[model samples]
Target: MLIVSGWIAVDPEAREGYLAGCRRVVEEARATPGCLDFVLSADPLEADRITVYERWASDAELAGFRGSGPEPEQTAEIRDAQVHKYRISAIEPP
Candidate 1:
């Protein structure tokens, strides 16, 4: 599996717009094939900061999503976003 973690900084005045865009992206992403999970969260300490967590079946699946440009509006709303993708061996037991 592939796991992705990221942070996005948004303008304070554009926070609502950013979140609306994010919701659209998340909905579309969740419907994509091989999308195991997709989540977005706001930083408790920083209202303008957003965090992302996602799991995909494989790197190829992720690449396919990226190639398809599924979330153009949301992608554009983010100020400075940094993402890290990792190959996951397992998920921690709950």
Candidate 2:
């Protein structure tokens, strides 16, 4: 399993607009095969923060869905990000 998780920072006032623009991405990702979960959410205490989390069955599925990542215009909106990918070796009850 592959897990992609991180947070991003944008202009406080522009945060909502940035997330609103991701509705399609969220919907499409959830519908894709091998996608276990995908989400982009606002940080309750941080107006400039957006939390990102995604789980995929494999690298191929993630790559197939992610293609080239955010569009240029959207990429330009982000001021910073701290995201990372993890390869899970085992799973157990949480």
Candidate 3:
């Protein structure tokens, strides 16, 4: 499985809009073929911080979703928002 985590810092004034856009993206991504799980969370102590947790079947599938499709625009909007740190890793369950 492919797991990705990202930390996002949003503009204080644009938080609401950013979150609304993120919600739409998450919903659409969750419906995609290779998406096993998708989640967005806010940091309790940080008003402008947001985190994304995602699981996909493979890197190719995730790349395909990133390129073209109905959710691309919304995803791009979220990406264009603010600076973020992200990581992707392979996981094995015991």
Q: Pick the candidate with the highest lDDT.
A: 2
Winner on lDDT (1 vs 3) = 1
Count of residue pairs whose backbone atoms collide, per candidate: 0, 0, 0
Per-residue CA lDDT of candidate 1, range 1-94, in tens? 9989988888877876777767877887799899999988877888788888999998888888768653676667777888899898877879
Better of 2 and 3 by lDDT: 2
Which has the better lDDT: candidate 1, or candidate 2? 2
Q: How many pairs of residues collide in model 3?
A: 0
Candidate 2 structure quality by residue, lDDT tens digits, 7-40: 9999999999999999999999999999999999
- Model 2 CA deviation exceeding 4 Å by range: none
**TM-score for each of the candidates:** 0.81, 0.97, 0.68
lDDT tens digits by residue: candidate 3, 1-94: 6777776666555656767767877887899899988877776777767777788888887887767643554344443334332444544576
**Model 3, poorest ten-residue lDDT window?**
77-86
CA shift at 94, candidate 1, in angstroms? Answer: 5.1
| Residue-level lDDT for 90 in candidate 3 | 47
List pairs with backbone clashes in candidate 3.
none
- Given candidate 1, what's the lDDT at residue 9? 86
Task: Pick the winner on TM-score between candidates 1 and 2.
Answer: 2
RMSD of 2: 0.6
